[model samples]
Target: MARITTPLTNTEVKQAKARDKEYNLSDGEGLQLRIKPNGSKLWLLNYSRPYTKKRVNLGFGKYPDISLADARKLRAEARTLLAKNIDPMEHRDSISNHQKEKIENTLLNVAKKWFQVKKSAVTPNYAEDIWRSLELHVFPYIGKRPISEITAPIAIKTIAPIAEKGSLETVKRINQRLNEIMNFAVNTGLIHSNPLTGIKAAFEKPKKQNMPTIKPDELPDFMRALSIASIKIVTRYLIEWQLHTIARPSEAAGAKWSEIDFENNLWNIPADRMKKKTSSFRTVN
Candidate 1:
């Protein structure tokens, strides 16, 4: 059992010397408190390993910031860990790693990683758009900073300037993308909090742009013009499918013969081929 020493007083703490100077406590445990002229106090615990008998310095409290009570608590904890046959340094490192993992799961980092993984899955043009919004508008100010460091105020600083420029639609689209990315980050353990949640006026609902359509009266001229322009049969058929079935351009161009049933004149596009959500195949006659 360790014996108690006289209580450490402030003047005694001040008179403590550094390097060559030492303020030795009565317990004779070689527990030294070194005080610099600047009044900064630091503790060093000297002890030997059980089997090796090698001397080692266990670092402890620093100055007034680490009160005597706190230092005692820390020492007690260290002793407990040592009793359990654990190295105090290794235990501290494990705690630090846990804390780092917790912080890494924040919304910002998770979103960035998610974007990196999914970005390649999108078409080149769409990927460019997503990257452009994030890099130009959001990443410059916030990318390298830790996600926990990004408060709602900081997030607003990253986005509000773009929102102010009458680009509500653009802002809305970016916000929605940001929302999905952040949500995914949460699901995958990247972020604990979604900064987008508390932001007001951070987004406006996007107005649906009516798709372009060609009237039936214009069809003959259009087909004739396309034929005169020497469009290939495949290209012509692809365009016709886009017009009739309201399929996206990529979907029409990328359709395979294997997906078409000639007997029923029905084309079945599998869910994987869809540019939109949902996985069920789409059919067109």
Candidate 2:
């Protein structure tokens, strides 16, 4: 049979004095005011572990300071957790640990973690370029800031100077990398949401530009200029080959003698080195 406890009043709690031996004043359902012999009154909850049913005391606060009402409220919350089969102490500790992690996980630290995972998917040179972009444009400003506190306004302000310099391409890449880091923080539980989701809209869009190429009518002048240019013989031949084949700079430079068929007189640019990853061939006429 369960024994009913009478609710304690403010007067009764205030009047409680230390006794020769420690004793508890029960208000109701597991909330108790423990009076020690040395005259300290503490409020705590008498609870049982959900599975093991082992009784444990969870302290709310000292009496009067915590008040009888506050103790009862805390006991109710703890009881709610117990009903859910969750230990209140463990829940409190989990929250405390998460807060500590947020404090320690700075933008630079989280970016580094994201990089470790990202670098595996990209080439070493390309990976270096990605990290270098952040170092030059981002780390100097908010690297030490906690990742959880970064917002779109803060990000725009940080990169506004670069945008002002008319380096729209660089700014665009910075915004992308910053959002990637923020999203990484979210996925890793360092932050609740991404604050830079739509940050790109804050800046002017980059203008559409086309790759400059030499026209057929300009070929004679280009050839004359290239012939007299202060460059090495190999560089001269390389430039001529680049223009003759009409291949992309990467495709031209990455060409090999082995890729050329003497009998066929065809320059075969393999799929790997060619843009769009498609093999291209040009007649050596």
Candidate 3:
């Protein structure tokens, strides 16, 4: 016949003194209170694997942090796993891994991961703008939610307030970014379909407005002002070049002397430099 271990009380556990050597106070069924020489009390479970029959020690936690009742509950759950022929530590690890994966698949997490890959292709200022928009508009509502849980309605709701504020352009841009993120999730196997696809149609279309520009009649005065203004010579020349060639400010700024075909009276803007690749050259004359 095997000797049975007696159950311990909370009072005995609390008052248990530490000695030169570490010792355990049994609470029956493998749960024990380990008292260390430094007076630290820890909860531990000693159990044998059902398959291999090898003994294992499972840490419940420190005694005060994990109350007696909680330790017993954990021990009972561990025993339940043992009865099912599963290792308790392995089961705990599986549950932890699942939770970690869930956190990693959250809308914000997935969006950030996608942003890391995208930021390299865009300017630093544009990348900062992308994150700023998300932090202000998208993160408050659905960022923490798992990507798989995001629905079309939720996505619409997230941007509806911005649309209602007459920021239709912002709404459109946010929707575009969300579409990219959701598409990334799909490609990565995190989701089956993009919930934000076609979501832009739900918002009001932005009104088109032409950029402010000087009228043809104002050109003489504009040129007079430019020539006399307290501006650098290079800047004045750049302005004159843009006005004559009708080139965008960016194209004019990036123009190299080598691309200027002075012999032919032509500014041969490279295909790569032209906004529309088809338009290759402009007659400077």
Candidate 4:
């Protein structure tokens, strides 16, 4: 028959004097109050591994620091793990490691990592714009949060104030940059999903405004003013080309001789050069 030890009480533990040697007063079911020779009281739990039957002692902290009730709650949690054949110590270590990883993988850290890759692909000025926007708008609220824990509501809330300020265009650009950053996180396995996905629906849709242009009668005066203006010959030609071809300023500026076919009277603007990808050709007549 197994030796049965009497369960210890808080009063009994308090009244019991510490001896010259360290001894544990049993609270039954693997929980004990260990009294040391120096009079310090510590809570400990002794349990066996389900697989190897190896006995292990797990500390539940100091007696006064962790009350009797708290110690029992911790012991119960440990026993629950034991029943499932899981080692409580190892489970606790895993949780600790996960929290540490989360702290290290903050949104700012991941965004910086993603920015390093992105900066190389864009011009320095554009990269500066992206960083400035993130620092001004996104960082204040959620930058320190774990990337994996940033949900759609968090992302929406971060940008809502900017949208509400009637900076709809700025909001759109920031949203695009955030989406790209989150996508990079997903692709790199830092996060499982992009929280900024479909985030545009949260904001009011921006109304489209057509580019301001001069009337047909006003164009001759505009051209006459351009001819007399002390501008470079190339600038004069660029203005003429824009007026005649209705090409955007960027398209007109970036035109090369190779793209023009004199025989066909056509300018083959590549998809990359055009504002829209499908607009590949323009009549040059």
Each candidate's number of clashing pairs is 5, 0, 0, 0
Give all candidates' CA lDDT scores.
0.67, 0.87, 0.88, 0.87
Q: Against the true structure, whose lDDT is highest? A: 3
Per-residue CA lDDT of model 2 for 68-130, tens digit only, reads: 888888998999999999999888889988788767898999999999998776544457789
Root-mean-square deviation per candidate: 9.4, 7.6, 5.2, 7.3
- Deviation from native of the Cα of residue 157 in model 3, angstroms: 2.2
Off by over 4 Å in 2: 1-53, 56-88, 103-105, 112-128, 184-190, 231-238, 250-285
For residues 1-285, what per-residue lDDT tens digits would candidate 4 score against the true structure? 988888777798777678999998898899999899999999999999779999989998997899888999999999999989899989988999889979998989989999999877664446777899999999988999998898889988899999889999888988898899889989988878887899988888788999787898898899889999999999999989987778877778888999999999998876665544444677887
Give Cα distance to truth, residue 203, candidate 4, Å: 3.5
Q: What is candidate 3's lDDT per residue for 88-179, written digit by digit as tens? A: 98888898987887788999999999999988666444677789999999998899999988999999988999999999989989999999
TM-score: model 2 vs. ground truth = 0.58
Give the residue spans of candidate 1 off by over 4 A. 1-57, 60-95, 102-109, 112-141, 160-167, 183-192, 203-209, 221-237, 262-264, 275-285
Q: Which ten residues in a row are the worst by lDDT in model 2?
A: 270-279
- Steric clash pairs (candidate 4): none
Scanning candidate 4 in windows of ten residues, the lowest lDDT window is: 271-280
The TM-scores, one per candidate, come to 0.51, 0.58, 0.67, 0.67
Estimate, for each residue in 15-134, the C-alpha lDDT of model 1 and write its tens digit: 566554544442234356766555567776666655566777677868667766666667777777767767776677788887887566554565667778776576544666787887
lDDT of 3 at 128: 74
Local error of candidate 1 at residue 86 (angstroms)? 19
